[model samples]
Target: MSRARRTLSATVTLALACTTLTGCFDESSPHDAVRDFLVGWQSEDYDLAAGRTDGERAAVRKALANAKLELDAASFRFKIKSVSIDGDESRADFSAEVDLGENNPLWVFDSVLPLHLVDGRWKVRWSPSVLHPQLKEGQRFAVDTKPTRRQPVVDRNGASLQRPQFLYVAGVIPSQLGDKDEEVVRRLSAITGFAQDRLLSRIRSSPPSKFVELATFGRTRYLAMKPKLDTISEITTQRQEQLFAPDAPMEIVGKVSALTPETEQKLGGPQRAGDSVGQSGLQQAYQDYLTGSTRTRVITLDLRTGKESALLQEWPGRENLSVKTTIDRAIQAAAESAVDQAEVSALVAVDRSNGEIRAVAAKGLDEEDDGLAGKYPAGTTFSIVASDALIKAGVKPTQRLACPAERTVGGARFAEAGQVGGPSPTFQENFAKGCVTALASLARRVDAAALAKSAKAFGIGQSWQLPLQSFSGSLPKLDSDADKAKAISGQTVQVSPLSMALVAAAVASGTWRPPVLVTEPSSPDPTAEIVPEPPPQPVALDPKVRTALTAMMRAGAVGTPAQTGSGRVYGVAAPAGDEGSRQAWFVGWQGDVAIAVLARNHDPAAVAGDFFATLHDPS
Candidate 1:
């Protein structure tokens, strides 16, 4: 033949030979080939071993290197009892005995490897390809067979929210399908909501091996369907010795093994199968604390008697700890309902004595998105900081102040929230009415730095360092005339609803406490006595101005807004003629509690009408 024809002929001959011996070649029975290859290498017959494929030869060489180390460093021997071939695979069940020459036998391992026959010989194959190369000649190793962990969740009430609801369960032996395999699968499929056809397909697809189907949240529905399906036929019932904590609902149970498929199937279900995890709300926030630890033990079976006694080593999973939150379920529900009526509204209730957050509700808004975590202009509420700064600067509310519609600082003119395009009122009147003009004029008197400092001390541009994430509302630095002007205008700073609540909380409690969502405080678990943060440094306020502000806020709540048609909570109406109805709010302390109510699309007239109507009807 010519050179090209000769090359082609040789390739064709090699292909033909491979095709002819395909059945004789068992890829799964390569243990002897592995052993022979390793021996050849140990005897320095590198060329003979190198004749095998690269992957197979590498596996042998690596095994030999490991075996050599073990033999030299310790007295470890894999006593092979017998090697048998059933079907197309080879299983070498061997005992690993160690002499522990200078070490403990525990450091050595005994393992059985199932190899496949390929190309008239056997080759080892790992189900997951990654584990194949890890096998060292004569080195004992176990295969990874189960599902890994997924993200866990829980409610603010410390309830376990998410868990494994399904399983890839199967029982295997070295013969025909286990007895009642069909019946067992049908029942399992019924309980697990697995399609009968799919279950049968999986069982038939893997001839002798057990079938594993990963379970999901739909377990409850499947479980409910189990009994109906179990009536179909007798299914294989293997004595499964699973040593792990079953997903229990609101109860702690002891560890059990060798449970029935029905028991295990039910054990795998969540509280409401797929309902345990946090689909929305606080469950999503504290996922880590809710997911507990896991421990797995796989027992070796006594094939003949169907007994599982060998104690395989246990691998521990992280324990999912319970986290208690500060949320009150009842109050949360009420607040959610009340505020959910508006397009946008937030309510925050806190203990006035120590700043413990009682409840916070953001209707139709995300706490992490456009809710407490986001920033918005503080509106007239920022007047608290401005008034404080101005008071500390020796400007009293009684001081007659020129209130103008517009004020210029650094040549930039700013307008008030509600101005009739006329000169503004006195300091007291401006602060009472939440006028932008009067406050802007006050901005000209106080230096920017002092105002900014006062705002920070009042919980602006800072977080309370809550374990749960919170937004640090930004404050405008007023170092110069321009800065002071913007600060007074409420234009430079960005505030969030949560930040606003914190500010109100600080004023209410005379201190700032970080907001907490986890039911259990990392420190001083809730089961114990409650402790409060230290008191805050006092902000100097003229008692008169403070009283005036408090009175004015009250007036806006049940008085000013009430007269303008925003009715009072107790039926007492103030002197009429109050104009705008911008989000009527009632923020004040009753005993040791500080409560704030924000209403959207507020119309004082309609509010007052409804209030009076309710009182008249005594409903």
Candidate 2:
């Protein structure tokens, strides 16, 4: 054979052998296989990732199935920094960035993936520890949360608003009583003042081993029924610390209860059953701040060995923070005492100087906050706004206007309650007497928009960003003369007790300042720190208009023959038979304190007077 021919044949044969070797093996290198496996795992494609594992496919699938520590898969990202291979074995190092949640801290970790050769092909060595160092075979990840202790709610003076009091919980243990359940329930009802049928139903539906709660009673009632209740075997009593003040305002302080499904869903995090949460009032409004923080831990539990170890994630619990309010205890007590007898009533007091709400009290009302949410026609109390509008319209308080027996406008008739028209009465005189016919007569003389604008100056129908949910009065558009007349007499306009209190405060301070309840905290912790809310921009009142409104209020409080006194009670009352219910309101300021009292089917002026008298003399 020739030398050239032999050399060319050997070169061709070597080239062909190299080509066959390349084609026989897969195109993906060891690094590429590892990278694809990691990508599949990050994307939550457990089946695709498991396919890359040799003997640990079942273990990898089990780990994915048992993973309870849910994280946003999209937020998980990783990049392979380097891959080193010796023979058939390879090691790939990568950095991973994991997102937890808004309330949780972000996680960053570096990990190494080990690959091995099996049957001349590289395959990932799957293990639970690949996901987390602490994980083991038959181990699963879970998050455990520990909630912090509840904080206290304080008044302006820093005194605890929720006092430690005895609350009698009446419940029945079905198994303990056996056949005596019916008799015991009957006796419990007779003593505890609960319905017998309700207790019986609760007992009947409950399991034999469980205790079913029926009702809770206050200290006085519990003490009165203790003798009879102690004799019943099925009945049990438990005393718990709750918000309780015999004379403290109930509606403003509010109440707490077990977490409802709605609140749990709203909370959107780990919360245990039977946890006490605020349901209404300021309690519900400041739940985040008051609830504190919960400790969260990601742990891996080995099902086979029954051993558990914490993963890389950990969130330490935070301390509870107290919520300090601007409520004055003395004023709240006085307001509560004032409305103790009224079937439906509310009283609110504000510091005229800084617009700090001092007291909020309501009685014989539903669970909803009635002190700031109850909508009622202002009746004659709205004359404050009308008087301001009239003055701004160049109408003097002394301007003579007719007060007839009755006047009809737009088919809506308005009449004077007590006195009929003998002649013409000055605007100030009719205002003091609360003459609806007189105000309605001049309704056509003023613009309704101007009236509403003037009312806004007194903080009526203004939106307020307060911590607690409140209704800051609302004014409907009045295009017709009759609507304007009704609005002027405070008939068509609806106002809350808090709104009236603010009106009186505006009249006294000559500037409308939104009411503030929570005092800003000085804590360094971001969670504990109270974000400073911008103070409401004050609305200035015209000096001339302010002076006229003040005089008119004083005149109304002192009756027809004006009497001189340090304390002034100025407000208006509506006829009992006119609107199916008697409504009255009195709003006035004494020194730096401005207060409003609203009563339904009762005299509000008298209630305001009594409240003031009690304020001056608590005896």
After superposition on all C-alphas, the RMSD of every candidate to the true structure, in Å, is: 14.5, 14.8
lDDT of 1 by residue, 1-619 (tens): 1223433543554355334334343554554454543234434354454343235555545544433332222222333455677766766554544221111122234456566656766654432111222332222322112323333323345543334334323332313545665666556565655445434433332213333332232334435544654454433322222212322211111122222334323433211111123322343333333433233332333334434434444445444454454544444444455455566565555554555555566554544443346655565566666766777788866676566556676776756546432453456566556565566666668877777776777667653545434565677555677767666656666665555555555554455455544435363222236665543443444455455555544544443333323333211111111123344443343334444444556432233333323323433
Give the TM-score of each candidate: 0.55, 0.70
lDDT of each: 0.45, 0.67
Best by lDDT: 2
lDDT of candidate model 1 versus the reference: 0.45
Model 1 misplaced regions, further than 4 Å: 1-213, 219-281, 417-426, 466-469, 519-552, 555-591, 595-600, 603-619
Steric clash pairs (candidate 2):
none
- Tens-digit lDDT track for model 2 on 501-552? 8888888889888887777443223354566556458898899998998888
In candidate 2, position 111 carries an lDDT of 84
